[model samples]
Structure formats: C-alpha cells, structure tokens
Target: MEDIRIRYYSKTGNTKKIAEYIANELNLKALSIDQNDYNSPCGLLFLGGAPYANIMSSKLREYANNLIKENVKAVALFTTSNWSRRTVRALKKILREKNILVYDEFLYVHMLAVNGAIEKTKLFVKNILEKYKG
Candidate 1:
C-alpha cells in the first residue's frame, strides 16, 4: 500500500484542525499545502482548506496549478465553508486540468467544532479505507 498524505491551507486554523484530525485518524502525516513536496511518492492526498472570500485559498490554488511531476494519483478535497460548493467545483476543475482524479468522497464540514471535525473525519476515513482496501 502506498502512503497517503494530508495537506491543507488554513488562515483561521479551522482547516488546519480538520486536516490534523483526519491525519490522526488515518495515521498519516499532515503538511501545509505550501510545504508539500511535489516530488514525494504518495499514492493519494487529502487536500483541505477553508474558503477565503468565497474562493479557494490563494496559496492552495497556486499549489494545485503548479503540480506537474508529482506521483500523486488522486485527491480527496475537504473544506469548511458557510455553505458553498464553489470551492470544490473550483478545485475539481483545477485537478481535472492536471488529469488527477478527485475521489468521489469529497468532504466539507460546514464550519464545525474540533470534535465535529474529528467525527466527520473518522467517517470519511473509514469509507476511504474500505474503498481502497477492498
């Protein structure tokens, strides 16, 4: 089994908390999207962020645009928004241009508490593990 990494972009720490919770649940390393090494040999990634001004975070948007030679095969996008699907749509469009498949399990927490994030992450991870493991 190849390693799956968790990467996120956050400003008010909401996305960071969700990312960390997911990473802990899956026992995977969580890195800031800015700090992710494009050369790393990861099978898939859980990319997360919080919407800023109703758009994807600038740094994360840039990172997704710049992805070229990475070994990542797929991504599961997670986000926290008041109630907008535009973030996922924007990210999906970007990833489509790069030819990276976005997993069907794209998750978004509607501005949740830390414990809420953890619980949601647990359910998401469980489904992902089952899909990949099966």
Candidate 2:
C-alpha cells in the first residue's frame, strides 16, 4: 500500500489537531502543508485548514493550488469554523477542478467569536474518523 500523507495549515491549531488524529489513526505521516514537499509518493492525501473570517487560510489555498498529484484515490478535507460554508465550498470547488477525488469533507464547530466548544469539536472529529475508517 502506498503511504498516506496528511498535510494541514492551521492558524489556531484546531485543524492541526484533526489532521494529527487522522494521520495517527491511519498510521500515516502528518506534516504541515508548508513544510512538506508534494513530490513524494502519496496514495491518499488529507488536507486541512482552519476557517478564518468566513474563508480558508490563504496559505492553505495557495498550497492546494500548487500541489500536483498523480492518481490520488481519496482526498479528505477538514476545517474548523464558527459557522461558514463559504470556505468549505470554495475548497471543494478547487479540489474538484483539480480532478482530485474527494472522498469526504468535514467541518468542526469552533469557539472563535463564540463560545469555545472544544469537547464538541473533539467528538465530531472522532466521529468523522470512525465513519471514514470504514
């Protein structure tokens, strides 16, 4: 089996936590999007970023635009947000345009500009992992 690679760009660490969980559960390497080179062998690529001001981090978007993957089977997206679909939709569009097969997408409620919901976010992440693991 080709190695799974999980990469993420996070501002407040929420998306990073989710990425770490997915990587650890899949026994794949977890790396910051900026720190890793995309030329490496990757069977499945999981991308994550935190939603900021109703948008995904610019850094993450730029990285995604630059990534060139051949035959990516499954792509997973995760984001931490208060309440905004714009970022997720934008990301989905970008991935689709790239012809990357997105296996699943997830959003975790965050405590930015609102009450912190760390526990809820954790449960959501766990559920996502469990569902995708099947």
Candidate 3:
C-alpha cells in the first residue's frame, strides 16, 4: 500500500510467480522489467529475478544499474532458485553502487516446483511490513 513498485526479470516464470504472489498479496501489480513502468519516486522497489546457471542475467543488471537513489529510497530483493542465492547478492551490489538502501531482510523462496509459494510469499510480505512500515 506504500509507494512500492514490483519489477522482475523471469525467464521461466518461476520468479514471475513469486512476484505475482507478492503483488496479489500486497495489492500491487507485478511488472516485467522490460515494461519500464518505473516513473514516480518510489519508497521501495521490489526487484525479482533468478540466477541463470549460477550467474545473474545482464538484463537484470542493466536495469538495476540505472536505478537512481533520488527515485528509490530502498530495494527489497527477491529471487527463485534451486541452488543459489547469487541473484540477491548481485542485485545488492548494483544497488549499493547507486547508494540505494537495500533491505537487510530479503525474500528467497525455493523454486515453485516444490509448492507453497503463495504461502511463502505471504509470510515474506508480512515480515516486510514489520520491518518497513513505509
């Protein structure tokens, strides 16, 4: 309900589902990174993506690099992966370069094939509210 924006680069729909779950639960629209819908000043930006073969995608990096601290106060990173948390670290690094505040708490639900993604996202969103009342 805050001026939060959700953007994700999901190649296999796994990360997209995570974004959708969070958006639906939080009443925000989940947008693909290419949508380029980030315009207004944002209190928090929820950027989602998954590592591709253990590395972060170029497209995700490009978008993150362009994030301005003047527009985004903070970022909440999320990713869907089977054996990696690399995406979170990679995004964090990009955000730091721009001097954007990255939340100490992040969301990393296991790949959707394991089920309970909606439940997991619900809990994640609940924690976000507790930490960031923005």
Each model's lDDT: 0.78, 0.66, 0.85
Highest TM-score model number: 3
* Candidate 1 pairs with clashing backbones: none
Q: Report the candidate with higher TM-score, 1 versus 2.
A: 1
Ranking under TM-score, best-scoring first?
3, 1, 2
Please give the lDDT score at residue 82 for candidate 2.
62
What tens-digit string does per-residue lDDT give for candidate 1 at 52-85? 7788878888877876536777778888877876
| Model 2 C-alpha lDDT per residue in residues 1-134, reported as the tens digit of each score | 24567788877776677667666565666689887566665666777776677777778888777666474555667666666656667777887888876655465545362235445545644665555566
**Alpha-carbon shift of residue 117 in model 3 (angstroms):** 1.6
Candidate 1 has its poorest 10 consecutive residues by lDDT at: 111-120
- Colliding pairs, model 3: none
Count the clashes in each prediction. 0, 0, 0
Q: What lDDT does candidate 2 reach at residue 130?
A: 52
Candidate 3: stretches off by over 4 Å? 112-114
All candidates: TM-score:
0.88, 0.73, 0.91
Please report the TM-score between candidate 1 and the true structure.
0.88
